[model samples]
Target: MSKKGKEKEEETMTFKLETAPFDPRFPNTNQTKYCYQSYIDFHRCRRIRGEKYEPCNYFKKVFTSMCPNAWVEKWNDQIENGTFPGRI
Candidate 1:
């Protein structure tokens, strides 16, 4: 492969994937509440701190890793339509 192509591959490979760390609040094997809380916290953070706030991404990453894709999509739609059950 060309040097440029190798460099591009290396750049993509540099990313590190991780799941949400263990939290004392949710010690059981079931992480549903943890995932949901992260989702709520992410939106709340965004609402209070604005979309550009970097810390908000931490919650986003946690929820995205822990919640199922369909759940995330439904929650996103609910938030858009002002139907989300959780307070933000």
Candidate 2:
């Protein structure tokens, strides 16, 4: 493909794989699942953008703003123990 075509494709390819339900607060359960998914999305973003400071900055901001510290800590532990559900 031409450079211009590739640029247009990249622009259109911007996507958010993780999304909250229509009414996130409606669920009887706590928001643990929401936080966990955002954590996973952060890692996925890093994986796609490479392990660099700049590329993953947006995701870092997103998860940090949305997910709590305790949940993120637990998820990190699970990841270290090789038991996290997501591939990343």
The best candidate in terms of lDDT: 1
| Tens-digit lDDT track of model 1 for 5-87 | 99998888776789999999999999999999999999899999999999999999999999999999999999899998889
The candidate scoring highest on TM-score is 1
Where model 1 places Cα greater than 4 Å from the true spot, the runs are 1-15
Model 1 lDDT, full chain set:
0.96
In the order shown, the candidates' Cα RMSDs to the true structure are 2.8, 11.7
Candidate 2, lDDT over the whole model: 0.70
Each candidate structure's count of clashing pairs:
0, 0
lDDT score at residue 4, model 1, on the 0-100 scale: 100
Clashes of 2: 0
Every model's TM-score:
0.83, 0.53
lDDT of each: 0.96, 0.70
lDDT of 2 by residue, 1-88 (tens): 9999999999998877654443354365666666556667678877787778485665566567667788778878988898877777
